[model samples]
Target: MSTDFTDARLLDALGTLASTAGAAIMAHYGGASSIKSDGSPVTAADHAAEQVILAGLAGLLPEVPVLAEEAAAAGRWPASTRMLVAVDPLDGTREFISQNGEFTVNIGLIADGRPVAGVVFAPALSRLWLGAGSKAEAMELPPGAPISAATRRRTIRTRPLPAGGPVALVSRSHPDAATSAYYAGRGIGEQRPVGSSLKYTLIAEGEADVSARFASITEWDIAAAHAVLAAAGGEMTQPDGAPLVYGRAERQFRTDHFIACSGAYAAAGRR
Candidate 1:
């Protein structure tokens, strides 16, 4: 909670918390799911994982307020504050129900409308990523292993766009016609379809060069991975090229259209 905490320490805490939540989510994997009031599907895994993450965050940083998906959907939100945690215990619920192994547990810290730290854990894939400040890393979490015990962490960064072309990552669930038209107009290379915030992480890890979102989305959907991408030397901004700001009171945390890109792709957009 204190600014004095180094990025490494914050990421470590977040990784641990996210790993715990991932375990909770896996417990309900492959089970029946119910629809929430908003028409989005919800499973016991979502609630159970949220509970684990919330408790873990409270224990790790009691001073920091938490805004979690389940709680927020129930009309529960923390008071207006610059510094707080945003969590999506089960992102990609449809993927989970379909057993596609793309869902993730996301936890992020937002300060002054910017994501400063975050952790994204995909239990189904046993992959975890952490980011804070200007640093980011990826590691594998063996089945039932705690994140604190994860070894072989590799520092991650975005690669420059190739001379031939740039690869784009797009949403699997909500592909937009405008996004496709934008890519075509920009002469983008291959496009990859992925679920959840993993698209952002793929770009951060240099697996893809850019991601453009046009559909309706909430802060919790992207904040954590946005932090990781930013920390990995990538950038996320509005289509008009302004930096994305979080913690909107009027919009109830919804996000506008934005593009997340590596430096090379960002430069290409400028051109």
Candidate 2:
């Protein structure tokens, strides 16, 4: 078994595992959803996908502890946090319930409170993005496609802020007045309301420039794509410019509001 999370073979396997979870999610998609104890919408898809991912991870990296969204929600968490796997089997449940193509399955490897490797797969769109160390890439993998099918992938990197100005990305379902004011204050007129971790992948791929949230979010919600963005030469930091850390079991893995920006935007102190 490969203990190196950044190994290309491991990354490929992780991507395949996520795609399998995506298939599970699609099986339950469009079906009725129920409210979790936290009042968040959940469907069979969420549980189904989580099962697939957890089982796969146990075989792939048995030594690493997994902190998964559904498990954490049930007050189950790994005792150790030194090295952890953050999993959000189905991110954007709302988008998933709404039947949009923006939902994703995320798996991130966190060590020393920093995400070192991660994969984000959007089954509906047949797109997958991954990152490790200082490298990131994206490819198309249909619902049941194997990792071997990811033969045509593009290496992705963040670009400098466009001359026209940074293109901002916001949540499609969680709009707020504070975010509106933040954009307006920066004279950011070009904004796209994206769903799930797609916003981070966009910034990592140079299709977008920045994204900010004024509300606290759970770690699994962003860790995977955060790794991708970081690997692609971007950064995800608190609004105060501090690095965002993960594996906060005490805080229930909740994170403060963060601003994600391309490398150039962060370099220019625009974050």
Candidate 3:
């Protein structure tokens, strides 16, 4: 917890690392491979991108520990956290390998087991989203190279959900038949096929109405976006309507599916 590393400073650093990581990922795009604990493909890009972000985070916040995706998958989790950085340095590696370019770099800071700040960067698309808990602004910055990212910052916010016919952004990569059925069950109109954590960001910006994830997912996948979505006037919650929570025991991470929707939806539902 370096007081010197404010949310703005961390996001700026995250932007720089994301650019470097994205570039590293590009080099190994379709040709990368590493074995996961379960023998799934980890990819060279995952390690390369993670290492770059991890080192940068360490340098920027010398007292903090990072619980990055690549590192956690490798059995390197952090302990005793007043502040923790969650990094999905290359989300959507499968999409990246398939060349769909829907991947992103996710960074989140948790205090007392809840996110206080976060950043998500989609490199190939050259887009970035970040938030500073309650004290600073949440924003979106367009794509730029790593070396030139420090100067670019743009503010962003969610518009109200439409009067009707709200758009639904679903998982382009992981939608199961049941998930599709769930959306259909909700009478959702105008579905957009998206990948990675971009689903929540879209909801935060009011481009989409809700996200119903009926399948399994990890905390690292959604926590960062959860922070931004909350700041942008949205909620990520379990289907039972429980508020989304993080930093539970390890088993909970894999089972934490959630739905994200506009602030109005909850109030409307209650009526």
Candidate 4:
């Protein structure tokens, strides 16, 4: 569990851990759910997946502290904060409860207030994405599949905005007026609604072009996918074009409104 491991090695470890956590979540996909004090839905799957991920992370990088959604909701915070792992065991619990295959398990490595490496695993979709540094990759793996060097993966990168316009992605469950207005004002007519952090990955893989969110979101919700997007030649920033960063303990790991887009779109002054 040396922290000196390379980003590629770290991504592989996280990919395996995320896939395992996804299986834990799938075990109770349709089970009962309850409301947390914050009014957000929580199910056994969330806890189960968190347990698996936390344990895996402990083994993978013992020195790095972990900040996870379920644990934080339960008032559990890691002691050390120099560098940490952000974990969202089940990112789209509503989607999971609704039996849609749009939820995901996210794990991101944070350093210097930015996500440097991370993994996003959608077990139901049999899709996985991971990135560290300039290398971002996506692959297919079943819910219970094990990851190794032999795992087949393809390099993924963001595509330049089309000559016509950039396709926009919005939250499938939390559409707001401000976001709609932002896109409409940009003359972005083609929009696709997606759940969870998948919107970031879509843009990362060149499947889409941009995502603008005026609504505030949590760190664990976007950190892993943010890393993937950055590594894939995309950028996430505030509406004023400031870099989106993580590990904001003062804000309880919450983030301000942000926009994510491909490098070309960003360079084109779309934000």
Best by TM-score: 2
lDDT per residue as tens, model 2, 1-271: 6878789999999999999999999988799999989889989999999999999999999988999999988889989988999999999999999998899999999998988999999999999999999999999998767888875698999997788888999999999888788888775649999999999999999998999999999889999999999999999999889988888888888888999989998898776
- Residue-level lDDT of model 1, residues 184-240, one tens digit each, is 877777888899999899889999898898776888888899999988999999989
Residue 263 of model 4: what lDDT? 94
| TM-score rank order | 2, 4, 1, 3
Please give the lDDT score for candidate 4. 0.88
Better of 2 and 3 by TM-score: 2
- Report the CA-based lDDT of candidate 1 relative to the real structure: 0.85
| Model 4: how far residue 96 lies from native, Å | 0.8
Model 1's TM-score against the true structure: 0.95
Candidate 4 lDDT over residue span 101-210, tens digit each: 89999998888788888899998998999988898899988876777632568999999778778999988888999999899878684999899999999899999999
TM-score list, all predictions = 0.95, 0.97, 0.86, 0.96
Clashing residue pairs in candidate 2, if any? none
Give the Å shift of residue 170 in candidate 3.
1.4
TM-score quality measure for candidate 3 = 0.86
